[model samples]
Target chain A: MSVLFFELAMTAYLVVAVLFMVYLAGRSETLTRACQVGTVVGFLFHSLALGQQWIAGGGFPVTNQFEAASFFSWTLVLVFLVIDVRYKSHVLGAFVVPLAFLSVLSAAFLRGNVQTIDPGLRGLGLTLHTSLILLGATAFCLSFAAGIMYLIQMRLLKSKHFNALYHHLPPLNACDWLIGRGVLVGFPLTTLGILSGAVGAKFVWGSYWDFSPKQNLSALIWAYYLVMLVGRYTLGIRAKRAAYMAVLGFVAVALSFVGLDALMGETRHF
Target chain B: MNLIVVGLSHKTAPVEVRERLAFKATQLGEVCRQVTDQSAADEVMILSTCNRVEVYAVAPNVDDGFATVSAFLSRCADGMDVKALGPHLYHYPGNDAIGHMFRVASSLDSMVLGEPQILGQFKDAFEAALNAKSTGMVLNKIAKKAISVAKRVRTETKIAENAVSISYAAVELARKVFADLHHQRVMLLGAGEMAELALRHLISAGVREVVLSTRTTENAHKLAEALCAEGGPPVRVVPFADYAAILPEVDIVLCSTGAPDYVIGPKQVSAALRARGHRPMFLIDISVPRNIDPATAHVGDAYVYDIDDLQSVVEANLEERQAEARKAMVIIDEEVDTTARWIRSLEVVPTITALKGHAEAIARGEVERVLNRLPNLGEKERKLIEGLGPAIINKLLHNPLSSLRKEAQERGGRDMVETTRKLFALPDEGAAGDAPAGGDDE
Candidate 1:
């Protein structure tokens, strides 16, 4: 049942992505409305899939690579829907929906035998650690999308292209605001996630600071966002530079979450 | 019924001629009523704007309608007659007229393609016609359909999305940099006609404040007073030497001065960006020798556009509007076909009804004559004979009636209606006079 819902959600996201592309090209209100409806429908099916998996596995569904990718995409879509409604910025979906779709597509390919959670790892601290970190990652993904838009818009302004892409994009200030908002919201959540993981690490491994690959990488991701936040608020490093930083920070986060776990065979995160 | 449009637009008439022929808003109703009364038109609408003056009407005969409307316009002109206005007038009949109305409403026929004012003028014209009682079922339906088509084009295409002039281009660029200009400040360096025009555009865009600076303090104070008198955001005059100190607080800088060398350069702009915490700044240099340094554009978050650059932007935007106009034309074409089909169907309705009525009358008369001769026949037998005549008539007319309806939805449906009427020798009921029951008003 979980697999069925996941497939259904993936199909909806694919449709939503295609509709957003057409909406960007044509700029028709009807197409925008269709994209919105498709996004909402996909989000509902994704939630159902995650809920089914959690009930079946008797824990949150972020244990394996497949479940982690699926959970990340679900949170990304959740954040996108919130921003979309709050700002009425449906144009942002053109950049973000495809990313979400790719995330789910990778999850589908990484699907393997479902594994039940270990009894020792089933606690509130572990759940908080996983959920907060995934949610923070989702927020950073939003910043990545905003940064890409900001760079494209800035180039158009600089080069005086004023092409269709330039006309369709939000203002440079709006893009910068999105980048700031993502980091502002994601930084604290990530800090809390890392702290919870530290406390949970002591209970599971009898150590508060192990310097494991995952622990080191998580701290690295946290510190990268910390610099971005501080630079934006105090040091006055913003606009183009901030956009570049947001994009690079997301790259680090993605590497820490996926590449480190896959390449380093001894990571205790598995 | 035939739909016809007659008059001249910027494409066909000079401004002098258009102005002379244009009707006042207060006179639109009276003029529409005059056309309907003096001509063969059953309905009339007059759209009079600075760019175009056109008459939309429904008439029984296109030729008569065209001639009468032409004569009416010639007489309405201030000092022109039929011969003087003849070359300027254009008349479109049938579906061409409907297509022309859709194009005009959608701004495809505008002097500035994709301009927004034409649609509002069109709606006002229709309203005037409605007030004058000069519009009937056909005009009402066509006008409403045109309005909706205009709205559809606006939403589906980016025709009106860009700035097509220099001053507006500056505003458009400023909007691209800042999310909202309502909180931003504008600094006007020096004073010139184009500079003031751009300043007015920015003010209307909701800039919070304006600071004027010039080489001469008296000129600056005079300009500041003039701008303040217009009742917008507060205007302050800063000395020419101190303008650099005010750069950090300004988001948009407009420079148009007679100075030979560059006034604002890369160094000053970079320093300002630093002081403003790297906020974006838009610099527009409209002077001939370029008052702002071009190298400032290389500074982070600083956009420098000279006069030539602004002109190029306008040209590019115009080209974009043209591309969007082509898309709008496609939408207009589809709507024209749909509206033409609806009108065709309307044309065939009366003919179909008349044909059926004519066949039924013949069948009833023949049945009555046969019944009179067979008086000894039983009542049930008489009823069977009566039913047989009507049944044969229904069977014989079914194919032709259904085909007439099918043909009415096509391009050449009017010919089919005429042929059907002639074959049946039915009375020619003017299609315009026979308004179908439940004819919608709008």
Candidate 2:
């Protein structure tokens, strides 16, 4: 049942992505409304899918790679829907929806990679560690989307090419603000995610410090985002520089979460 | 009835003639009533803008309506003779007129193609005619359809999305840099006509405040006072020497100084960007020989566009508008055909009614003649015989009448109406006179 709902949600997101692309090419209020409706429908199915998973697994469903990726995308869509309604930035969906679709697509492909969590590890500490990290990653995904838009808009501004993409994009300040906000929200959550993960490690692995590749990479990803947050607020590294950092930090996060885990076969830490 | 449009636009008439013929908004209702009263037209509307003054009318005869409206137009303007206005006037009848109205309302026929003001002007003219009760069924339907068609064109095409003027281009560029101008400040360095125009556009876009600085203190103070009187965001006058100090605080800077050298350079802009924590700033230099250093564009987060650059942007946008205008024309053509067909269908109603009435009259007369010969028959039997006559007539006429109605809604439907009239020996007057009334109920 959970798989069925996940597939349904993925199909809705795919349709939303296509609608947004058409809207970007030829802007119309009707198309925007359609995209909004599609997003809401997809979000509902996604929530149902997650709820089904939670009930079936007897815990918050972020234990395995499939559940983690699915949760990441669900949170991304949730944040996008909030921003879309609050800011009335309908065009932002053209950039964000595709990322959500791809995240869910990866989860579908990794469906067989679910690792059964030990019953002893089913506690608040493990749930917090996984859910907080996934939420933080979701925020970074927003920054990544905003960063890409900023670079495209910046190039258009510098080259004086007011093409369709340039016109559809949000203003440079808006993109920069999103990038800043994402880092601001993501950094603290990541800090707590790392701290909680370490606390959970003592109970499960019999030691808090293991120096494993997954643990090392998680620390590296957290530090990278920390640099971005500090550079944006205190060091005056902003606009183009901040956009570049946001993009690079997301790359590091992706590498640590997906690449490092894949390289070390049969890893206990995700 | 024929739908006709008789008037001159900027394309056919000079400004001297157009201005003289333009009707005042307050006088529109009276003028429309006068046209309907004096002309052969049953319905009348006057659309008078600075670029064009057109009279839309539904008349019994196209030639007579055109002549009457042309003469009235010449008389409305003082010192303009009919011979002088004759060369300027243009007349379109039937489908041509409907197509023209759609194009005009959509701004496809505007002097500046794809402008937005013409739609509002068209609506006002329509409202005036409605207020005066000068427009009947035909004019009202056409006018309403034109308004919706204009809205459709605006949404379906990017015809009015881009700025076509330099000052408006500045505003568009500013918008591209700042998501919302309501919180952003603008600084005007020195004074020039184009610079002030750009400043006005920015203020209307909801800029937070305006900072004015000029080489002369008096000019700055006067400009500030004038801007403040406009009742927008507050305007502050800063001394020329202190203008650079507020660089980091302002988001947009407009420079049009008369100085021989550059008033703002890369060093000052880069310093300001650093102080502002690298927030983006838009610099527009409209001064001759340039007021801001061109190299400032290389500075991160600072976009510098000079006069030539702004002009190029306007040119590019105009070209895009022209391309979009072609697309709008296609939409207009499709709607014109649909509306024209619907209007033609109105002509079929009275013909069908007449055809049904003719058949029933013969049936009733024959039934009465036969009943007189069978006075001894029972009451129920007599009623059944009377009903049989009309029932046969109705069944025989149903196919022909329905086909006539169907043919009337397609192209070349007029020939079908004429043929049906000749075949049935129906009076032509009913088809012409009852069309407007039939359309009213619809």
Candidate 3:
């Protein structure tokens, strides 16, 4: 049942991504409206799929790559819509929804079928830890998209060349604001999640500071976001410089997210 | 009924002759009344713009209406050669008249093609004619259809998309950037004729707040005072150094100065973009040595269009309008066909009204005789019997009425209408259309 819902959501996101790209290509209002409607419908279906997975496991169904990726994409869409409305930069959707689509699409291929819930996962602490980490990751994903747009806009400005995309992209100031918001919000959530996980580790493995690969990656992710915040606020680094830092941070986040699953064989983040 | 248009325009008449024949609005009511009082036309409207003077009328007979209007036109401008004016005065009758009107209202017949002023002029003429009690159902229907045709030509075609003038082009591009100009603020970075012209267009386009900033405070104050006196949004004078400081709240910056260096740089705009919360800003640099930095176009959300860019936009727009005018012709043809069919349907109105009246008279006579023979009938039974007569009459006439309407839409609809009118003994004067019940919506 969860797999059926997951496929349905993937189809909706695919439609949204295609329509948004078309809207950008031609500046068509009809296609823009269609893309907006598709994103909203896809968001609803993605939630239903997450709910089905949760019911299947009788908990927060974030125990594998498929489940975590699905939740991550859903949170990205939610944050993107908020930023899009607040900034009045609807063109950002053309850049953001594709990121959401790719994550959910990759989830469909992963081993996402429901499995027996481990007794170690049966608690509020682990549930809170996983949900917060996925949400924080979604915020960082948005920062990555904004960072890419900022660099493109920066090149256009520096080269003194004008094109359709140069005009359509949000002002460089808005991109900077987007990156700042992601770090400012994502940093605290990630901190709490890491702390909660270490606390839960004491109950599951009887050690607060385990040398597991997942723990090491989480710490690395936390340190990177901390440096980004300090570089922006204290060092007075912002705009293009801050955007570059965000891209680097996003790369680190991605490696630990998908690369760990590929390189380490497994992670207790499940 | 007959439709006729008699006028002199920029096409055939020289400007001098047009001015001579033009009727000033002050005397328009009196002149329109004189023509209508002569009973030369059933309905009359006068459109007297600087480019043309036209009279649209519904007449009892085309020939007599033509004579009366031609004499009126000749008398409007005394001392002008009536014979010389003869060659200038042109006339269109029947469907040709409607086709001419639709084209004129849609700006196809304008001296400046795709210009919007003619539609407003036509509407003002229509309202004047209505106020003078000179137009009725047919003329009202024609006027309303013409307005819609003009509107469709504007929207469905790209005829009005690009601005034709330099200042207007800047305003048009700004409109494209920001959909609503009412809430947008404008800042003029320098003092020059180009800035003044662009400012005028922006004010007319609905930008209500303006700031004038220049290197010299006195010059800025002088321009600001002059602009405020010109009847627009209040113009505030700001120091030149404050341009970047005030840039955050402004939605548009019109820069035209004799400066050798860039007045607004990318860094300044980047800072403003951040301060303004990333709202899009339109920078129109019309000076020869451009005032705003060209690199600022790369700023996220800042759209820069220089003088060259605006000129290219105008050139491209002219070509677009030329392409769109062909499409507008198709729309005009459709409007003409629709109006012709409606007039054809109206041609059969007298026959229907006459036939119904004739049938009802006979129905009433027979029902009265039968009721007198059955005086013991109950009230409900009496009412039922009375209702039966009209019901039977209506049923008997339904087939013929519908067929008559169908024939009105065919190739020989006018002939079908004429034959029906003769068979029913109805007059060609359109008696039913002039009746109170036949009046169009108020």
Model 3, B21: alpha-carbon shift in Å?
4.9
lDDT of 3 by residue, B54-111 (tens): 9888897899888888877887767765577778988899888998999899998888
RMSD of 3: 5.2
Candidate 1 on B187-215: residue-level lDDT in tens?
A: 99988789889999999999999999999
RMSD (CA, angstroms), candidate 1? 5.1
> What does candidate 2's lDDT look like per residue over A103-130, in tens digits?
8898898887666677677688988999
User: How many residue pairs clash (N, CA or C atoms closer than 3 angstroms) in each of the candidate models, in the order given?
Assistant: 0, 0, 1
Each candidate's B-chain TM-score, in sequence, is: 0.85, 0.90, 0.77
Q: Can you give the TM-score per candidate against the true fold?
A: 0.84, 0.87, 0.79
TM-score of predicted chain B, candidate 2: 0.90
Give one digit per residue, the lDDT tens place, for model 2 in B1-442: 6799999999999999899999999999999999998888999999999999999999978999999988888899788888989999999999999999999999999988889999999999999999999998889999999999999999999899889899999999998888779999999998999999999999999999999999998999998888888899999999999999999999999999999889999999999999998888999999998999899999989999999889999998889889988989999999998888778777777777777778888899999999999889998999899899888988998898767766877754678878888998988855445632653233
TM-score of model 2, chain A?
0.95
DockQ by candidate, in order: 0.64, 0.64, 0.19
iRMSD, model 1, in Å: 1.0
